[model samples]
Target chain A: MRAAIFRGAFAIQVEQIPDAALLEPTDAVVQITHACICGTDLWPYRGQGPYQPGWQIGHEWMGIVQDIGSEVRTIKRGDRVIASYDFCDGTCEFCLQGLDSACVQGGLWGFGHEGGQAEAIRACFADATLVVVPPEVEGDEALLKAILPLTDVMAAGHHAAVSANVRAGGRVAVIGDGAVGLCATLAARRLGAEQIIVLGHQPQRLALARQFGATDIITSNGDEAVQQALEMTQGGAQAVLECVGAKETIQMAVTLSRPGGTVGFVGAPHGQEVPLGHMFSSNIGLRGGLAPARAYLPELLAEVLAGRLDPSSVLDRTVSLAEVAAGYAAMDQRQAIKVMVRP
Target chain B: MRAAIFRGAFAIQVEQIPDAALLEPTDAVVQITHACICGTDLWPYRGQGPYQPGWQIGHEWMGIVQDIGSEVRTIKRGDRVIASYDFCDGTCEFCLQGLDSACVQGGLWGFGHEGGQAEAIRACFADATLVVVPPEVEGDEALLKAILPLTDVMAAGHHAAVSANVRAGGRVAVIGDGAVGLCATLAARRLGAEQIIVLGHQPQRLALARQFGATDIITSNGDEAVQQALEMTQGGAQAVLECVGAKETIQMAVTLSRPGGTVGFVGAPHGQEVPLGHMFSSNIGLRGGLAPARAYLPELLAEVLAGRLDPSSVLDRTVSLAEVAAGYAAMDQRQAIKVMVRP
Candidate 1:
């Protein structure tokens, strides 16, 4: 099986690897149909995070089930599916409470387990982690584009909006104009927010954000952005979706939120210290984290299937497994919002 | 008029000061019958916060309205009332949304405007800030005690629980043993939390916490208390109320909350920095600050009038006007949980 393997900083190679198989009773073997690079993948590629030299590197995927273990009851062999970046036992307390990201036995693909950026991949907790595509939608390009990101990005965007408690007539702001931030703009719009502000400096990304339902845009001057956000919302945003985890982004999200409003931060924060006094004094709420992707995939897929959301718009480039390294380079240089790779 | 004035650190004097009068068109002058030293009041006296010399201190009070400005409509002379620590224009959007503490024109009584620590205090936004004592309740000492804290501490505790979204059958952990913490325990109980853990090192405060319906107590031993709380509540507390504004207590509160749970912080956080990465990764929600005391006072007053809640039991001492300085000393030395001062 050919897989995209991380060799070193900014280096990825499509190399032959041993075929995947069911490692647990709840596991499923899937033949990868589509996979993509995520912003999180850039961490290891940039040498900012630990990366095992031959680790398969990708977490977002839409594929066809090739085989299933005995305990996999809901999904069957030959089923087309979208699987989340992390696998979780659905019956766990955390999973039942819609916190699949915190499931006791959950494991991250690409990092700890085999990932989908390959010809074939092994998925654990198959029944709970896989969302089968409707037969009517099989192989549809638009649906596939939407489905692939649902496994991660779209769900992450939804996580940001939901955690921030976005609602009808509320004012919402997205801090990052990455794929996740654009999706968040759409999510807030879908959730009935009357005003959506996207803060980004990149022209292309900001334009996409506007197309995705952003009512306003603030080019990344932190102070001016916060002031504009507050002024536009008549005080401050009712909910701020922080999709960029940098310290400046986090602070901007907090500062832009109205007193008693919520700041939903989905971006994985790097080296950032939060001012506790400021947060406390403003009566602001903070909620975010790794997306409970599995918990949200079904709903996101439903929306995608209905053509209500189009997460595929974020895909700036698509390539074959052999060109996987270029996808990383394009994303690293901010040349692409996202890159989809065919296995 | 006699008032308790902060002369210096650990030094207070009860001396005659100019009597307060209506300072604004919306102001009212109140002749305080009772006032108390809050946990925050001890901050400056303990030399832990910046204190200006000869600053009049107390903010919590129950009194009779002595004079009303032409703009004061809801409150009039001779009406018995309970006033919040902060005065707000109730007609503002923020106030209408139940965020009185964030009112644009609001001013904190003790910190910014004339406070009720004196015989007569000028209250701004009288119509929006004062809650009248029900005519049916007269000469009730317990109700008086309960109502006094409702002006700030009790209301703040209730805000903590409400802000954290405490639900029936949920588990709550309160990190602090001050008046606000004890009030949080009571508020959590009122909100129907099935399990309540009060973390503290003092026996008397712990006993009071238990009396206020805390089902468990964790004698502080660093992270051990958080571990015990997590173990007791299965994964972690569904809601954690941080009543101590110190860094360690804030950290402990976040540590004890389960993923997706809320950490309601009502304490005036000092110089503390929280790690955003840890909080974001855990998906714990944080909400709180300067408890919109005016918002909760009506409901809390109802509970008190109905004999369903009593907050004054936490008061360990009561001093006359001349000995008000001693009340601060007692609280500063940890000799009293709360002190009620009679004028």
Candidate 2:
């Protein structure tokens, strides 16, 4: 089966890997129908994150269940479903607490398990890890790309909004213009933010941010961006969502928030250190971690099916599974916002 | 007038000083009736925090309004009131958001104004900074000690609980056995926590913790405390209150909380740095800063006035204004939980 593999830094390849098989009673095999290159995928491609020479590389995926182990009772063969990046046993204490990201036995798809950018993938904890697409929209290709976001990015954006405590009529500042940031802008809007502002310099991405519910955009950085946000909010935003994990973005999140507001960060932080005294003096609340995507699936998926959210606007380009390297290169070179692949 | 001054490391002296008088139209002078030596006060006494010899040193006090500036409308001469450690304008955006600690014109009691550990204090923002003692309990000394906590420690503890999102049926673990920790135990109970645990080795402080509604006590530190907390909670406490600003206590607060729980801290952290990756991977929510005591006052003061909440048990000793140095020495030597100064 053809799958995406990390050959080296700046080198991702579409190569034939061993086929997946049911390894446990709780496991299910999924035939890859659609997949996409994620922002995190660019981490290794840019030599920013861990680089393994030969490991399966994608996590966001949606496909049809080709087969299931005996223990899988809720899902069966040939059902379209979205599998979140994280797989967890639904009954663990952490899972029950809506912290599936910290589930004792949970595993991220690209690590320990096979990558989703393949012909088929084997998923453990199938009953608790997969969410079936509503029947009415399952056959549409456009809807496929839209629903695929629920597997990771959209849910992550929702987590950022929830962490920042975004509410109806609240104001939010989204830092970063990546797919996740755009999704967060949209999520904050769906959560009823009266003022949605995006801070980014990229023209194409910023345009998408506006379409996704950003009421304004500041093509600036540092204190300049902060000033614009404060001026727009008439003081400072109630919530600041840091979607890019860079230290600069994190600092900007703090700078853009009001004294009593919150900053929610979902990006994997890089060299970020919080000045305790400043955070204390300002009474700013910092929250957010890995998204409990599975925990948010049912509600967000309903929004997607109801046509209330169209997250696939982030998918600016598409390709066949065999041309996966081109997909990675395009996003890496900033030639495309995101890439979708049909297997 | 006379006031305590930081003479040098491990040295404080009660010496003759200029009397407090109203200078600003928003100012009001208070005749110090009672004051308390704070845990933060011991910082300079033990040579830990910034040491400025001869600087006015106390921040918590309650007294009768001695005089008022022409603009001071809320408080009048001869009225009993509590002067909190923080002075906020009460009309700023941050103040209106219930975050008086972050008020734009706010300043600590001793910095830009006279410290309260003197015969009198000149308080700024009088209308917003002082809360009147209920008429029914004005002359009650026992009730005075109880209501005094509402000005600082009790309100700070309540901030920790509110920051950690403690709710009915939740479990709480309070680290540090100082006045703030004991008060946090009381506040968590008031916030409706089902179980409360204190982690400290001081027997007397632990006894006070129980009296303040702690259900259990763990006299350990480091990983040992973590293991015991895990065992007691069968996982971890729902909320961990870090009242000690040391590096070790902050780490314990993170280590002792459940995966999805929050750690609320009110201590003025001394050079603390967070391991962002560990906190993120664990899905622990860290929320806390300086407490907005003024926002929490009316409710807590009501409880105190109603004879439902008593926070003065932590005040284990008393001293006259002339014996201020002795009060500091006793508290610095761990011979007293807290010292109540009668000016």
Candidate 3:
């Protein structure tokens, strides 16, 4: 099997690797049909996060089940399914509370298990880890490409909206114009936020944001952007989505929220100190952490099948499995928002 | 008039001072019938928070409105009322969203205005700052003292429950065994939390917590308390109320919560760094800052009048205004949960 590997910092390659097989009765093997490179992958790609040579490198995926262990009850062979980047049993206390990301028995893919950016991969807890691709989206290549982002990106955006309690007729400010940020704008719109403001300095990203449903865009960075957001919303937005988990972005998110509004941050935290005094004295509420993307996949998938969502726009570039290394380079260079991988 | 002054660290005095008088048309002078020393007041008492010599200290109050400026509308002279520690313009965007503590026109007391532990207090935005004491409890001294904590402690507990979204049938862990923690146990009961766990050390405070509706008590401290709470809940609590602002308390609050659970912290943040990585990976939602007691005043006032609540039990010691300094000492030494002063 051909698999994408993280060779080292700024180094990636496609190589012949051992084929994936069932290690547990609950496991199922899938032939990767589509996969996507996420912004988070860049952390290790740039050596900001720890990585070992030859680490399997992608998590977002959709594929056809090639085989299933005898114990797998829900998923069967030959069925198409969208994979959850984080594996969960769906019945643990955390998953029962809709927090699938923190599943006690399941962990992130590409860490211990083989990554999705490969010819085939073993999915642990297959009965709970895989959701069948809606029949409406079957055989639709464009839909398949679009729905692939749901495994992480779109579901994350939807999580941001839900976490912030974004209500109809309410205003929200989405910080960071990455794929997650753009998806947040769309998700806020889908959740009925009347005024969606996307804050970022990148013109191209901001433009794509507008197309996704942002009612306004602010092309400024830091404090100035927060001030503009506050002014635009007449004080501050009811919900501020901090999609970039940096110290500055977190602070800006707090500033962009109204006194009683909520700042729901979905980005991976960078150990930023949330301004305790600011959040407390202002009576502002801060929520959201890692999104339970698996919890949101079904709903986001329905939206995609119904044509209310088409997030494939975030897939600005595509590459064959052998060319995934180049795909990573394009994303790192800001030449593309996200890159789709065909296996 | 006599007013309590924060002379220096561990020093408080009730000294003869000029009488409080209306400075604005929206101001009203209240003859304080009751006031209490709060846990947060200890911050400066311990020389932790910023303070000034002879700064007017107290912030909780309930009294008869002796005078009202011409523009005061909702409240009038001779009405018995409960004063919010924080003054606010009811019409401001923040106050409109029930965040009166962050009123655009108001900050906290003791900055420029007279503190509540005085014979008289000039309350700005009288109509918005005071809630009329129901006629039925106008002459009830015990009831008034019981309601005094509502201005800060009890209201804060309620804020924790609401902020953490403690729903009916949910289990909650209230960290801290202070007046606020006891009130939080009471609040979780009021909000319909089924199993209320109180984490603290003092047997007296824990006993009071049970009286206030705590179903379980863990006297152990630190990581042990969290593990015990986790065991009692069979996993982790749905809501965690952090009433102690210490760094370690915040960490415990997160540890006590289940994934997707919320930790509502109402303590004056000692600027403790929230463990973003722990909170993020656990999918734990953190919310709560300052409590807008004024927002919860009306409902709580009704509860008090209806005899559904009697928090005066937290007022373990009583002292005349002349001995107010001793009242501060009692709380500072942990000899009393809270001390009430009659001026």
Give all candidate RMSDs, comma-separated: 1.7, 2.6, 2.5
lDDT of candidate 2? 0.87
Query: What stretches of model 3 exceed 4 Å from their correct place?
Result: A21-25, A48-50, A69-76, B8-11, B46-50, B53-55
lDDT of 1 by residue, A1-343 (tens): 8998888888888899889888889899999999999998998899878888888889888788999999999999899988898888898888999889888888788885797789999888899888898878775777787778888888889999999999999999999999999989989999999999999889999899988899999884879878888899888998999999888888888888888798888999876466666677678888889889998988887888888888788998998988999999999999999999998
Worst window of 10 by summed lDDT in candidate 1 chain B: B270-279
Candidate 1 regions exceeding 4 Å error are B23-25, B48-50
Where does candidate 1 clash, by residue pair? none
| Position B108, candidate 2: lDDT | 78
TM-score of each model, in listed order: 0.97, 0.93, 0.93
**What lDDT does candidate 2 reach at residue B45?**
83
Superposed on the true interface residues, model 3 gives a C-alpha RMSD in angstroms of 1.6
- Top candidate by TM-score: 1
* CAPRI grade, predicted model 2: medium
